[model samples]
Target chain A: MLDSALSVFRMGRNMARLMEGLGVTLEISVVAVGLSLIFGVPLGLMMAGSNRPLKWLLRGYLEFVRVMPILALLFIFYYSLSKFWNINLSALTVSIFVFTLWGAAEMGDLVRGAVTSLPRHQWDSARALGLSEGQVSFRVIIPQAIRRLLPGVINLTTRMIKTTPFVFFINLPDLLKVGQQIVEVSGLRYPLASVWVYGFIFIIYFVICYPISLFSRYLERRWAS
Target chain B: MRRARFLIVALALALAMIVSVKAQAGDLDDIKAAGKIRIAVFGDKPPFGFIDENGANQGYDVYLAKRLVTDLFGSPDKVEWVLVEAASRIEVLQANKADLVLANFTVTAERATQVDFAKPYMKVALGVASPKSALISKVEDLKGKTLIVTKGTTSDTYFSKNHPEIKLLKFDQNTEAFNALRDGRAAGLAHDNTFLFAWTKDNVNFVTGIDFLGDEDTIAPAVKKGQTQLLAWVSERIEKLIAEGFFEKAYAATLAPAFGPAVDPKSVLIEKLN
Candidate 1:
C-alpha cells in the first residue's frame, strides 16, 4: 500500500506540479488577505462611526456578500463580467478579486462586531478623560478592538485559504485541481492513485491551516493573560 | 456629502470601464496580430486533452491544437493554452478567454446555438462503462439505477433529457465521475465512447459493455459565435488537415497507445469532409 502510494509522487514532476499548484493557492490567499486588511479595517471603522449613510451602505455590501455563494460570485466575476462587461481579467485575477471582496466584507463585519461589543462606558470614560475623539479612537478603542479582532482575522485568513479551491471551477490550476490532474493521469498505471494524491492534498491543506489556527490560539491565550 | 460624491465618482469610473471596451471575437487577422492563438483544452480527460506526467499538456486534442498553432504561426510555441473543464468550454469561448476550443468538444444542436463548430475531425457516441459483475449493456438496463456522468457532458445531457427514469449522479469533473463509478456509487458511468474505450483499457475491472449509445456525433473545434472569418479559416484548415491525413497520425501518436489493440482507429477518426 505504501509502495503504491509513493508511486504517485514517483511519476514525472507530479510532486513539483503539486507544489506549483500550492503556490497559486497561497498567492491568491495572501493577496486577498492583504487587500482585505488594507480596506476592511478602514471600512469597519467607518461602519462603527456616526455616519448613518456610510454605515448603511457598508451593511448592504456585507449582507450581499454574506447571502450570496462564493462560487456564484466567482462565476459572475470570471465569466459574466468578462463577457457582458468586457472587463477581461484573467482567471487568477478574477479569483483574487472575488476573494478579496469576500474577505474584506467578512473582516469589516468582524471589526464592527469587536468594536460594538465594548461597553458604552469605555467610550464615555475615554471621552471624560478629555482625550479628543481621534485620540480616544486611536489610543483607547483600536488597541482593545485589535485584541478582540485577532482570532477572527486569523480564522478568516484560513477560511479564505480553504475557499481558494473554488477557483478551480473557473479553470485556475490551484493545488486541488493539479492534484486531480495528477490522479487522473497516474490512474492509468495505478488504480489506487486517487487515494494517495487526495491524501497528500489533505496533508498539505492541514499543514497550512493548522499552523494558522495554532497561531491564532497562541495569540488569544497570550492576549487574555 | 463628500463620501457620497466620492462613491458617485467611483461608480462612474466603473461604468466607464464597462462601456469603453466592446466585446469582439478575435478574427484570423487579430490572431495574427497577437502572434499567439489561445486554444482551450481539457487538463484531465485522457487520450483527448490531458496533462502528461511532465506537467505539460499532451493528448489527442492538444496534439491537434499544437498543430493548428504551428500551421498558423510557423511554431507550436506561439500557442497559449487555456486549460478548461467540460462545463466551461462554451463559456471560455463566449467570454473571449480562448480563441478556439479543442477540448474534445462534441458538436450538439444545443451547443451549436452558442458556438460555431468547425469541421469535425473525430466521431463519437455515448458509452456506458460498468463493472463486469453487473454490466449495463443497454439503455433500459440503466432504468431506476444511478448513472454517473460528468456535468455538462453530452452523456449528462442525453441521460437528463432522454432517460429521466435513470437517477443521474453528476460531477463537475471527469476524475470525480470515474471515482464515483469505481466506488460503486452508481450502476454505470456514461461518457464518450472514445474516452470509455481508453478508460476501460486502463481500468481492467470495468467494461464498456454498451459501446455505442445515442445518435452518432462528431467532435469539432469551436469558436465564439459569429466569428465568421475565423470559423471559415478553421474549417478550411480542418479540410486541409483531413486531406493530408493529420488525424490518422494524431490517432497513431496519442489514441492508439491509449486504446490498445481492441479499438480500431477508423472507428473514431473522421478522415474526410463532406
Candidate 2:
C-alpha cells in the first residue's frame, strides 16, 4: 500500500503535464457541441417543417453524416484539403470541423425526434391561437421541445468529449494523446507507471463525464416526472 | 422468433469460422501450395511501403513482397497486402494475420525474441529533422523543445531512454508526426534516416539535421517465431535475390523515384547468410 501510494504521487507529478491537453479537449468539445446546436437546431427544424424535396435532401445529408465514419471523414478532410488546395489547417480546426459534422447530424436527429413526438394537437392549438406557422414552431413547439432536447444534447456532449481522442490521429495533443505520450515516456520507470497514468486518465475522464451524465439523467427524471 | 434466433446463431458461427480460417498461419509448403503469401507492409511510411495518391499500394517493401511472391507462386497477383502500422507490424505477423512483415522493420533484440528476422536487406539509422526557419539542427538543440516521434518507433525509445529532458510528442502515425513538425507544434521530427531523407526531399521547407543518431541498424523482413522452415526459405530467397540483382531492380522501380540517383543497392543490402 505504501509503495502504491508513493507511485501515485510520482505519477501525479508527471500527469500534471496533461492539464493543457485536457484544456484543449474541453475547448474543442465545447466549440463542436455549441456549433452543432447553433446549426443543427435550424437544420432539424427545416427537416421537420420543409417541403418534400428539401426534406429529402436534408435527410440524405443527415444520413450521410451519420453513416460515414468520423475518423475516415477526418482523414479525407485533412489530407484532401492539404494536398489539393494547400490549405494545411491545424489539427484542432480539422477536429472541430469533423466533430461539428457528426454532432450536428446527431443533434438534428434528436430535434426531429423531439419535435415529431409532440402531438399534432400541439401544432393545431398553436395555430388555433392566431399564431403563424413560423410563430407556432418558434414560440409554441420549440419552447416545449427544449426540455426533451436538453438530455439528448448533454448526452451527445459527453460522447463528443469521449471521441476527442480521435484527434490524436491528426496530431492534436488532446488529453488521450498526452496520456499516451506520458506512458511512453515514463512507463519504464516502474511497472506501475502505466497503471498510474492510465488510471489517472480514466479517473479524470470519469470526473468530467460523470457529472455531465448525472445532470442529463437528472434532467430526464425532472422532465419525465 | 426461435427460428430466427437459430439462423442468427448459425450465421455468427459461420462468420467466426471464416475469420479464423483467414487468420491461420501457413508453413512453407502450405503457403506455396496455397499459391498466395500474406505480407504486411506499412501503409503510412513512404519509400519503403505506403499507399500512393492513386490508392494503389506502392513502395520498396511492397515491390519486394510482390517479387518474392511472384518468384514463389509464378504470379505477382498471388500476394495479399495487409496494411500495418509501425507499432503492430510484428503483432500482425505473430497473430497469423500476416505471413511476413516487410514494413521497413528494423531488427531489434527485443523484437527478435517475439519474431524471427531474415537477413538484413537495408541499412538505416535515426534521423532528426526541423523546420528550416528554426535553425534547430541536432539532438542538443532539442533541449527544452518538443520533438515529435511516432509511437513504438526506435526514435521514441531512444529519446525516452537517453534524453529524458527533451519533451516528446508521440503520434501513432508518421503523417501526424510530420504534420506536427509542419505546423510548428514540434521543434523536430525524428525517425529512420531513410524516411527523413525522403521527407526532406519532398518537403524542402524542412532540413534534416542530426543526419544520424545512435548506431546504424539494419532493416529486414520478419516472420512468426519458431517458423524455422519459413524463416530459412525467406532468408535464402533474399540472398539469391540480392545476388541476382532483384533488389537493385526493385530499388530502381519503386524507391529511385523518391531517393534519387546516387543510392546503390549494395550499400544497403546484406546477403549470403547461412
TM-score of each: 0.87, 0.48
Which is the leading candidate under lDDT?
Answer: 1
Write the residue-wise lDDT of candidate 2 on B175-213 in tens digits: 788988898998999998777766776677887776778
Tens digits of per-residue lDDT, candidate 1, B156-193, equal 89889999999999999988999899999999999989
Native contacts, share recovered per candidate: 0.81, 0.00
List candidate 1 stretches off by more than 4 Å.
Answer: B1-25, B127-191, B205-210
- Predicted model with the maximum TM-score: 1
Model 2 clashing-pair count: 0
lDDT of 1 by residue, A1-225 (tens): 889888789788988999999999999999999999999999888888889999999999999999999999999999998788877788899999999999999999999999999999988999999999999989999999999999899989988999999999998999999999998888867879999999899999999899988988898898889
Best by DockQ: 1
lDDT of 1 at B42: 95
Q: What is the C-alpha lDDT of each candidate?
A: 0.90, 0.77
